[model samples]
Target: MNLIPAYPEIFLLIATSAILLIDMFVSDAKRNITYVLSLVALAGAAALSFYSFEAGAVTYTFNNMFVSDPMSHLLKLFTYLGTAITLVYSRQYIVSRGMANGGALGGEFYSLSLFSVLGQMVMISGTSFLSIYLGLELMSLALYALVALRRNDAVSTEAAMKYFILGALSSGFLLYGMSMLYGATGSLDVNAVAKAAVSGTIKPTVLVFGIVFVVAGLAFKLGVVPFHMWVPDVYHGAPTPVTLLLGAAPKLATFAICVRLLVEGLLPLAIDWQQMLTVLAVLSLIIGNVTAIAQSNLKRMLAYSTISHMGFVLLGLLSGVVGQSSNGAVGAYGSALFYSITYVLTTLGSFGVIILLSRSGFEADKLEDLKGLNQRSPWYAFVMLMLMFSLAGVPPMVGFYAKLTVLQAVLNAGQVWLAILAVMASLVGGFYYLRVVKLMYFDAPVDNSPIVASGDLRFTLTLNGIAMLALGIVPGGLMAACETAIGQSIGHALKNLASIAA
Candidate 1:
């Protein structure tokens, strides 16, 4: 077995364990040492991922259960960036809330966070059912703990319990679906399953039956409507940092698994799964946008906004194929990939602003809290404005380009109505997003305290907001990166997908 493909995961695991041991002797007052080490581990792993990147090439290890490819490397790089920035943004917030100190979360937040990133890395690299499931559980468990880390917070406890229960149910759905696929295909490896799915020897009916549960599981993870009951509650109830933790990095991992399972593993059933995704996309867009309009709680509104944005991602996923052809598969999937990456980047900034406003005694979670932010600090307010514009899919921001590409992909795939519907949904969604901007620029100041954030947080938040506009103006590079990554993986799979479409 070529262990070379697994180096990043292995290094992360070892580094995380060492951080745990080293932190045991360090006092909470000196916890910055642990924080520094955690960031170093993430940076090291990111470097390794970048070094190993190979366009249009794939490598496998651990008896082919772990695969390293361009897409994995790219997503892993973004994952590292997202996780590190999340820590930087939330560092003071965590300390102020006592999650970094003695009686509550202790130093485990750092270790648990690293471990969760490791799990996400594993998930991004997973090439088989067992590996994917193992990775999912690891990440889910770490996040569950992180959610309840504030031991005395009744809301955190409730949120953690709900997340755990829903998470467990989703896992069960995934495992059952995998078992069904295994029973039909007589294999656990994704490649083997792909082969079996297209072979005339296996029963297509059985595969479709299994795909239902699989899509259900995937839908739950993506936080689309119907399966999205847990999202707003959890996002509102969990500590803001944990909310960012749950929101950002894990999305790339989930997108990876969705592609790995549905596109790579079961391209033969594209038509069936695409239909499922279509219904999910429509419902998510309608419900997520409409409900978000009613929320005064900023976190919950963002949570619903997450659902609608995910619907656009589903649009790209489902647009990969038209009947009897793999036409537009690369562009469609690439658009979805690009959208996911940019969405996370935008989300990190938006939530970072929320965290920046939160003091030891203040949560800064209500919509009114953002009132007259521009009057307080024009720079921070400007950053928040860019992030809101991005989320609202306004032009000159990355979110606009992301949506445009996905809509183009959908149109190319012959879903003209879907594309139109997506545009309308975005228009409706823009109201709440722009409402925030209104509060920041026009509303009276509710509190006049000076905005204070660590230098690192401010630096990253500034860069993050700038990246949104930068990518929108010249989205070619990231767009091409996503296209190339998806094209490399889809090159062979499209041949099979063609047959399924036919």
Candidate 2:
């Protein structure tokens, strides 16, 4: 089998291992080497993904257990970029908190993050249920450790325990569902399962049962309602940098898996899964948004906000196969893809600012901590304003367009009620987002300490914030990229279906 399709993953594995080994020999004063190496590894992996990407090419390897296409390439590239940005935003916070002590903890943190990124890459390229499960576990295991890295913090340890227990339960649900699918279809390959599903050989009851568990597992990963018990605690308990890592990049992987399982493997059973997603989406919107308004902790608020944003993603996904309109499928899925990317972009900046405001012996995680941020740093206040407006889907922000596209797709599929419900949910969520802006500009400073951040942190945060407005002002290029990636992925899926039929 050809190996080019797996080159990026292979390179990451080697680079991570090398960095881990090298980190052991370095002193605390020289720990910057390890951080630099980690960033370089991510950059190299991104370059490799870009180098291998083609407009419409799809490559499958390892007996078709892995597949690389435009969707995977685009997602992988962004995942790499997101991880790098996470590291950059996290460096000062990590150092200030003494978590980067150049000992086992620091080394483990960086290495584990690399492995987590590697897992995301695997999930992005996986074409078999086994590969996807393996990747998910790798990522989850690393996150569990990262959450507990500040071992002395009781809250951090407690959050890790909760996350581990819930995460393990979710994994069990996913595994059981996969086993049931295997029993019905007699195959572990996703494409094979799809063929069996469409061929009318499997029991409808068994398939629907499996789909329920599978969707539950995926929803848990996406932090949607009914399975989001861990998000607020984990975000609130974990160190701010770790929380940033947790919130940002893995989202691309979660979305990738959703596309693989729902759109790729189980398209034939879309009606059933779509119904389930509709219910989940509505609950997430209502619960996540309303609950977030009650949260005084900024991190906890964002965690709930994440659940609601994911609700919108689900809306786009469920709208894709509502009827027999092929164009509707493309528009709906493309909109979801665009929404996911923009959400991650905005989330990185939001957390980056939080990290910037944090210093030794202080955690800037409370809503009150942001009062009169404009007085502390007008530039950062402007950055926060842009991020908040974008998250609120206000005008001239990419988030507004992202929501518009998804709602339009939903309406196109004759889901007018769902679209209207989504609009109402967003309107409600806007209150909390805009509240942050008002606090920054209108209130007096709680602490007159000036915000101090590394030059790298300030530079990255500024660029990251500006990207939100820039993309919002001119979203055509990114929109076209999403459409093209989704189109190519659909074409590939169709080709696989045709081959299965033959």
Candidate 3:
């Protein structure tokens, strides 16, 4: 088998091992070596992904378990870029909080992050349920410890405990679902399962139950309503860098998993799943938007906001599903795909700003903490204003387009009622996002509120925040990318399933 396509992950594996060895040998005085090495490793991985993308589809090793098709390569590229940004913004935050190489933290944080990125790579390239779960576990386990890295802090410990316990429980549900799916189809490959789904030999009840459980597990990761209890506390109490990871990279992997499992593995059952997602989307929108209004902590509020965004995504996903519903056959799959892509960029920018609000012992997580931000730093206030405005679905902001695209997708599929609910919730959600802007620009600063960030941190945050505006203003490139990626997944699955059936 060809190996060129596997170069990125291969680089990541070697780098991860090297960092571990170096961290063990290096003295505390030279511990910065580990940090520097981690950055270089991530940079290398990013380069490899980009180079592979230019060369086009390349499948290498394990009979297709690790293919670097355009969709996988593109998502992997974004994942690494986001990881690099997380490390850059987090370096200073980790240092200031004494969360690097001292107390309960060290080079391990960076190392774990590398492994998590590796997991995401595996996730995107996964061709079978086995590969998907392997990636999911690797990512989740690293995240569990990362959340609790600040061992001495009670809040951190509690958050880690809750996340770990809940994460474990969710994994069980997902595994059970996979087991049922395998039993019904007698295959572990997603394409094989899709073929079986269309064959009509599998028991419908078993298939439905399995699909529900799998979706349930995914909902936990996506922070959808009913499965979102862990989000606010975990986001609030975990170290800020860890919170950034929570809000950003994982979304890509989780969405990838959902696409592979639901659309690819269970394509024939799309109608059933669509109805289920409708219920989830509406409830998540109502709860996420309403509860966010009461949150005083910025991280917690954003966590709730993320839940609402998940709802919007679910709405789009359901629309995509209903395209097959005999009612005009208008498809929203393309729209759903675009919505996930933009959501990733928008949310990452929003949280990156929060990570940079470091002032020695302060973490700037509370809404009141941002009082009169404009007076202290108009540039930051402007950046944050862009993020908040985008999230509020205001015109010309990326968040606005992200929401509009999904709503349009739903309406296209004739799910007008669901589209209307999403619109109303978007309006409700706007209140909190605008409140953040009002706090930054309209309110007076708390007596000593002077926000300061490291130079690198400030620069990256600005770039990330500015990107939202850039993408929102001219989103065609992103829109095309999303359509291509989603179509890639669908086409691949259909081709494989058709071949298997014949």
Q: What lDDT does each candidate get?
A: 0.92, 0.90, 0.82
Tens digits of per-residue lDDT, candidate 3, 234-323, equal 999898889988888788888788878887778678777888888888999999999999999999999999999989888777766443
Per-residue lDDT tens digits for candidate 1, residues 135-222, read: 9999999999999988889999999999999999999999999999999999999999998877879878899989999999989999
| Model 1 residue 457 distance off true place after TM-score fit, in angstroms | 1.2
- Point out the higher-scoring one by TM-score: 1 or 2: 1
Better of 1 and 2 by lDDT: 1
- Models 1 onward score TM values of 0.98, 0.97, 0.94
lDDT of 2 by residue, 1-502 (tens): 7988899999999999999999889888788888899999998898889987754588899998999889999999889988999989888777777885633237777899999999999999998999999999999999999999999999999999999999999999899998988888998888888888878777889999999999999998999999999999999999987888889888999999999988888887888999999999999999999999999999999999999999999999998875433457778899999999999999999999999998989999999999999999999999999999999999899999999999999998899999999999999999999999999999999999977889999999999999999999999998888888888876745554445435
What lDDT score goes with residue 414 in model 3?
A: 76
RMSD of each: 1.3, 1.8, 2.5
| Stretches > 4 Å off in candidate 1 | 54-56, 103-105, 498-502
The clash count for each model shown is 2, 0, 1
Candidate 3 regions exceeding 4 Å error are 58-61, 103-105, 323-331, 447-449, 494-502
Residue 305, candidate 3: how far off, in angstroms? 0.3
